[model samples]
Target: MQGNKIFIEERLNDGPGKMRCRINFRFYMLLLSAVYFTMLYIFHGNLQSETQKPDRNKLSMGVEMQNAFLKIQPPIDIKRKVLASHQEFVEITASRLHVQQVFTTSGAKRNDIEVENSIISTKRTSQMIQKTSECFLPAVTPNRTFQTIEPTFYVYSAYLDRRYNDRFVRIMALLSLNKGNRQLKVSCSFRNSSGSIVETTANFYELCENHGRMYGGFILSCPIPNSDVCHVNVSLQIKPVHRNYVVPETVQVRLPVTQLGWQEFPDQTSGQHENHGQHATFDMPYNFSICVPPLFGDIDVMRFVEFLELNRILGFQHFIFYVSTIKNPDMYKILDHYKKMGIVTIIEWALPSNIRSGQIWYNGQLSAHNDCLYRAMSLTQYLAIIDLDEFIVPHNGEITLTNLIPKLFDDKVCGLSFNSAFYDKKFSKSTSTSRLLTARHTGRSAIFSKVRTKVLIKPSKIFEVGIHHISKPAAEDFKVDKVDTSVAYLHHYRDCVPNYGMKCKDFVEDNTLLNTTSQLEDNISSVLKLVFKERKKQE
Candidate 1:
């Protein structure tokens, strides 16, 4: 009985110990499962965070939105197909809205209706931001004015003139000067790229100073203080020494700056120790360019075509026409067609309303001519400043002006003064009944003189240009050489004018213009056809 009781107690104690051991084992297993799951969750979170991290080189939201829209946007045909099905269109629009919301919004809790409304609001806000951005941003102010009578000067353009050893910025303008205004003090305020402004006294030079005119072209020269600044905005403050004149006390005008000389050879360094003759080293884009003054009134299209074609045949590569007012649509269309073909450039040259009444000649011809002079300065080797009616006809068997110029003039000759040979419109020969004006008017005046003559000038060698002649040469040695009548002459076609002491009744039969008549006709026909064809297509 004693042995049975001892065994039973030992069995009870051993049962309790085994139950405790089983509980401890289950607790350890639970702890291990918790730790493993926690580690797995942390690892998954780290991977997701790495995947969702923003790129360092990511574009702006607007650019990204544009790119994204372009990528998913359906083509025209696909859009048509989608539009055909109302249900599909609605679904696609919804999908697009959803995508846009994803791009534009952050994570926020909202119902379907709220989300749609939010997307619409966000899109509108983005559009407003984009539209206002242009209005707020700072930009270079263009040289223009609407003021009629306050300012006494009209600033045209600013140029970085590196022609001389002392590099300076030349500002071209038109000053209204009276007899009372003897002396003028000019100052230039230059604004650099970093918004820094510098002011200096400028040397003012009137182009037609000795002419005793009311209004004339003037140039203001100021030394460039900062060579590092590539671009600058120049403003001129002109104060007349004698305030007794009609001119204002102080007139301020701002102009857009253009760098000259460097455009011809961009790689070539300026301020080099080179002579005026070394300008030939630079390669010009055009060998020859014709600068026509501001064309106003009704211009005959046939005559205009003939002039362009004849000049083109005479090896004039480019034509720059400053248009003041062209009433004829056909004339504009012809100019546009030529502009498209890269043969012509039409500049809108509407003069200030105040100056138009008492303007110098045909809406500021002097200013326009000088503008063309500077514009074509770096572009072409030679520029012929002439009117639409005049033609520089080479009579020495050298058909092209390109060929004739070199043979006739030397390097020192900067300009060729062609004596005028009047072709009176009323004196048309009975035998000449051709459609072309040049062919129809074979009778030219016997008198050929330098009075009211035209010039073909080397743009680089001439500085300030005039209607009939070059007012200023770039260098002292560079001169205007008068071409003999046998070599070349300006064929001035106009109505009978006996005011200049020349009788239009006495006309010599000179068919010099008819040399290129055949080629001119063909070119005119081809150009007109293409112009009309293009017009039809546009219509």
Candidate 2:
């Protein structure tokens, strides 16, 4: 013990000895850590290189470039234009509901065709929530078409205040001014039902592209007592930005409650709007007419042939198509054949040479759709606005639309809306068909993922037409009904990618997964059988 104590004392006396021992231990620990980390780093680097080499071919350069481009680009700021600070009522003339053709010196095209008996006239009464009447003429016509008196700067609004039963009014109008002329004073005045002039100024704001095709507008919002305004006058009291004009045009348009979307209206007439009782030869020939907008893009002709045959089997009597300037020749050849048979009516939508491409309010198709609706009102009891790829499938066992609709629909219903179900090309199933052409086209899927909506309505009730929904507001008596998917819905086939092949990736093994009798496959089969038999006879 005494010798150990002496050794300890010696160690304590040597201060550098203990310090050196501690320094050696720390150096050893650091060296071990460095070696461990180096080994891990080398292992990770080699593994990563091996994994990346295999993935290099799969990586998309185009996608990377697109992402980078999107990341660098600035976003467009959009705001809705406010047109009024106070509210006023305007009474729309029922007889003068027709669109007025405006003549422009620059554009060579003239809109001489007048769509008559489109407006349903009714006596103005205090209790009338929705009165069927004609409405606004589009300001932006085709380059060659006659220009209407309405300002080229167009405005429309659809707003409902949940707090009160009444809807808050908003107006969006576009102002056509010289380039760089940003600021201008605008006024809106209308004669109210109480025989007083209600006038207010509009505050304009530019909106974003997300608002869809309608151009940004100068908006007006204000609160007014519930009264009708007979006329609305919008004027720009500013000088030209560049051109020398006699005066800035004061754009005038009649104010109809229906135009303001204050009430719900029928989408089709009950054949009451025409003088049908007088003509003995005018037998009720058709039950329902399907009105489709002009065809765009290079659509497959076989698919369209399938569409017509199937619809006929489903009991749709008449068809109307607006033929745009560019259409597939094969598709048109078939359409021409149908037109000769008097089953199809083709309206040429001669777009102005100056109009920019893409979907917008200025697209002549809006007018075309409305025209078809009015024209078909007297021709058929019901009219449906649908797309080429859309199929209105009934959930009930009833075979035809006429049989199914009567059981589910009534006169009180302004529109029978069917939710849209999206069928992707990835899940298409193959059908066992001996014919090569039939086999090639029989792969569309019956199953779907998402549901958008399309409407079937009476023409007399529709005040305004929209892409998906009616623009007119709903009243107590008239409103849009969302039919249960179990009753019926639209099968909207969409492309998985741009021009994706018709074949589906995931084939549904169970043929009965759709659980409905109106399976598109079955419909297609029935139509093809009839068509093939007819062709054989002709040959």
Candidate 3:
């Protein structure tokens, strides 16, 4: 009985110890499972981070590149400050016009001078004073010519454009002062028939934005309330933008204002003006005209003839040539002959003594084009600003621009842009019996999109002109249409392709220029013979 009692006590003690062991074992297993799940989560997170590392690096690189670009080409409004006088005008015209803070790439601001109920007057002491609207009309006195200042900017031409209801004078000029970086305040002094001077501030705009050239083109828009102005003088007030820069003396240019007729005429019977009505009953002198860029250097006489004759056959009635330098005397005789025939108008494009011939964008071709645009605005229905070697040829056996233009342009369209197909001189083949250069060059490089393209725009509908496109259109509804290559393309004849490391190998046969080769050759030969014969007589 004593042995049995000792055995039961031992069994009860061993049962409690076995339960404690089981509980300890379960706690260890739970801790190990948690550690294993945490390791797996950490591994997955590391893999995801590695996959996204390249995107983060690229984003950082993009930010660095943007910083570098900002350093190289600064924003247009860098360090821009508004003049007190200009600021006052900005406040007055704020509701009427969108006052833009104009500045150049060189960190100079061009303040838009908009005046309301104010006029600029000069007293006997030769001091400019601001007067109220009551003093807008000065006493009718003898017209006095202001002393001409030294030439700072080359003024090409000025015109009084009354095409829109708002009458403004447009001055086309080359911004040749201080490498196109100098900031100068511009104003216009208008002299009416009564010999009174009315001075007003002008708005300036650069046509080309840092085209990688030292010089640039500008258009000075001077708004005049009254259109009865005989002469307008441009006055420049020089101000130094940089600390080390020296300010030049104030310069003045006197320009004769060529007045243009209004787009719509008042009804004679009712004496009421109509908006967007039929055009004035005046006859347009030319249906289609071409504005050739500043002509310089050694020009191939044969190629010149071909350019004019082919375009003439394609319904170009007039050609305006801005002559910088003609190396060949025969070219002069040809231009003179065409001038006498009333088919060509030559303007002397002499640059300033300090400016080089080809330094500015193709010898200030943008200025010349803008000048030609205004000059031809009143005369031609369509104006094409193209280089000497480029030609707009129609496809599908279309000959004249008369038919093609109607199909391409409507009332809503104002500008037509054409892509270029370069006719490399090396790949030219003598395919035609007429032996014309355009006819011989049948193989052209593949058509490129927006590469060295040219435009044909309605001169009246264009507000600002550029080398390859229109900078501003006259109306918001008037948009540019990119003509399909299947219809037409620009025939750009050059010695080499423009792209770097591009072999002039891939070429397609385009003989659309040969459509009018027979007539072109006859006209060119006749012109050449006449010009040479006349040259012999002069010699």
Number of the predicted model whose lDDT against the real structure is largest: 1
Model 3, range 1-539, lDDT digits (tens) per residue? 36645654465477658666555556656777889899999999897665544342344535555455446552222211212343344234332222111211012211133111111100110111122111111111111121334444666566676655567888776665354445677789876556677788878788864376656777888888744654577877776667777776666767655444335321212223235555642435456779898798888888888888778667676788888878987788778666544456677777766666456767777777887787766556688889888888787567777678867877667789998877876676655555677877778875454756789987777788788887887666678999888788788888656574344667777767666766666666666766687678978
- Count of clashes, each model: 0, 37, 0
- Candidate 3 clashing pairs, residues 3+ apart or interchain: none
RMSD vs true structure, all candidates: 18.6, 28.7, 30.1
Itemize residue pairs with steric clashes in candidate 1: none
lDDT of 2 by residue, 477-531 (tens): 5577888877777766565332223333443432222332234455445434444
Report the CA-based lDDT of candidate 3 relative to the real structure: 0.63
- Please identify which of the two predictions, 2 or 3, would achieve the higher lDDT against the true structure: 3
Model 3 deviation from native, Cα RMSD in Å: 30.1
Per-candidate TM-scores read 0.68, 0.46, 0.67
lDDT of the candidates, in the order given = 0.64, 0.47, 0.63
lDDT at position 347, candidate 3: 72
List candidate 3 segments past 4 Å from native.
1-151, 176-183, 192-195, 241-245, 261-274, 357-359, 428-434, 496-503
Give the higher-lDDT candidate: 1 or 2.
1
Residues forming the 10-long window of minimal summed lDDT in candidate 2: 79-88
